[model samples]
Target: MPLYKTLTPNSQTTVKIWKITETYDDLLEPISLKPENMKRVLGMKSELHQRGFLSVRHLLLEFGYTDDDLFYDEYGKPHLKDGKHISITHSFTFSGVVVSDGIVGIDIEKQREKIGVIAHKFMDYEYQYLDQSDDKYINKLIVIWCIKESLYKLFATPGLSFLQNTLVIPFTLEEASTHAWIDYQDKKYRFDTTFFEFEGFTCAYALPS
Candidate 1:
């Protein structure tokens, strides 16, 4: 059980992270998944994905929930049966979940330079503050990307564009937190974004503020 970290951001929210080191069989041993989730896990082509899926179940147990208490909306956003907001993320060997009283979203992404090549596809206003020549460019990009992803998951609205609609305010890597806005269909929403890094991976989460 590589339960890496647990964080209580507020009285009504909790975040849990898992460092996956268990084999597929080992991970499958403890939790009994609902039939649909079991079939979903079995149908995953990559064993790494399977393990990440299973580790999330363990995270749910840490919060006293199970697969039976979870469901996905048409947009694929996860929901708790008790009506609490839930957001989930996984990347490489890490997986995480955020349960909150308000709308929330989370994402974990492996830091890599490859993101630079496609930065323009999902970035617009952020370009004003990004210095491609800076040594921390990749890290900065990853944080912004994760921030947008979190907001997207929180919104769960179809046809939203990361580049056009989601905007992350200027912030330095040292800040580790910032503000973001979603402007779509003549409506504006705001969220507080926070980020952290571990073992070459970056995790970002957001909550309606």
Candidate 2:
């Protein structure tokens, strides 16, 4: 499951996911990293985080990109040398990337009951339809969190608060898609969002509408 999945959201965008089933040495063996990234990875204190970082490089290769083609801004959002938009995320054993000609974002998050304990920290508007008593409560919360994170990565604007600035329109798992908005600085930006569950995690992505 090194390359767990791939998505072509549109002709101009691509998404790749990797399941970190490889050891650090196994993943590093095939990668060519610039000195800075090599040091960053070497300084990681957790093997899980280290493997997650390397797995993303593998995801980049799946998209026909090399580590050299990617760079980050002061806000920590990723950019491509070719000018395509790119977003990266990894949680536990899974890592994902989305690259596009236009603004785009993607995220992967493991569903956990703890998310419910802090849902209020990042939720608004969504409360109108959410019911913690439902069996799918935690699942829905994870979806919203991942969706907001995707939008946040796309926005990458400082002072944008997830609880106050982003909203995921009402949706059910079966629908597989929904409308999301980022209301920041008095500007309301809409996005076409999609999500799916794999194993125990949720992955969501957003593109400007």
Candidate 3:
């Protein structure tokens, strides 16, 4: 019942969203973070980390999988017993998952009032189109951030930064739908993005070109 939207980027991939609420059954269970994930969650600022994990677990349940059904390999990528390509994300009260027979990715981010200081780290050519001085800037930034995060999750690479890589092409944010492309090792990827208001955050998912 958590699916918010479904998208088909190509004949081979499908991406879906889930809005995890407090009523979600898994929210009450004690978190059992794996040692590796614990390293990051334990050091995180608390609420964000806990909410993220709780959301992810609930999303798995929506798919008929449980917390015990997930395992992370040495590369830090999560592996499901069913062997599907998966990506997980949570921001504020929203969490999302993208699963595909092929490679997939997804991301969700809290719509902050201001992302001023950190903008430079993620905004590149997309900056020219952005009216950072405008009141709508934070929402615009979240759109770009979610798209980049999806691409990162899709590739599962370590050193790529949104500012230097992830090309969002060009699109109008007018109708809550956008298109983007990413070039990874000479391969071009096409992504279709849609922004939805969910639990006070902006959520997006992407798949192969």
lDDT of 3 by residue, 39-101 (tens): 655566766556667667666766667766788776677777888888887766566776678
TM-score of 1: 0.98
lDDT for each of the candidates? 0.94, 0.93, 0.69
Name model 1 segments beyond 4 Å from true: none
- The digit string of per-residue lDDT tens for model 1 on 11-116 reads 9999999999999999999899999899999999999999999999999999999989999998898999999999999998999999999999999999999999
Tell me how far the alpha carbon of residue 109 in candidate 3 is from the true structure, in angstroms, after superposition: 1.0
Badly placed stretches (over 4 Å) of model 3 are: 1-26, 29-48, 185-187
Better of 2 and 3 by TM-score: 2
C-alpha RMSD of candidate 2: 0.8
Model 2, runs deviating above 4 Å:
none
Question: Per-candidate RMSD vs. true structure?
Answer: 0.7, 0.8, 3.9
How close to the true structure is residue 72 of candidate 3, measured as C-alpha lDDT?
74
**What is the C-alpha local distance difference test score of candidate 1?**
0.94
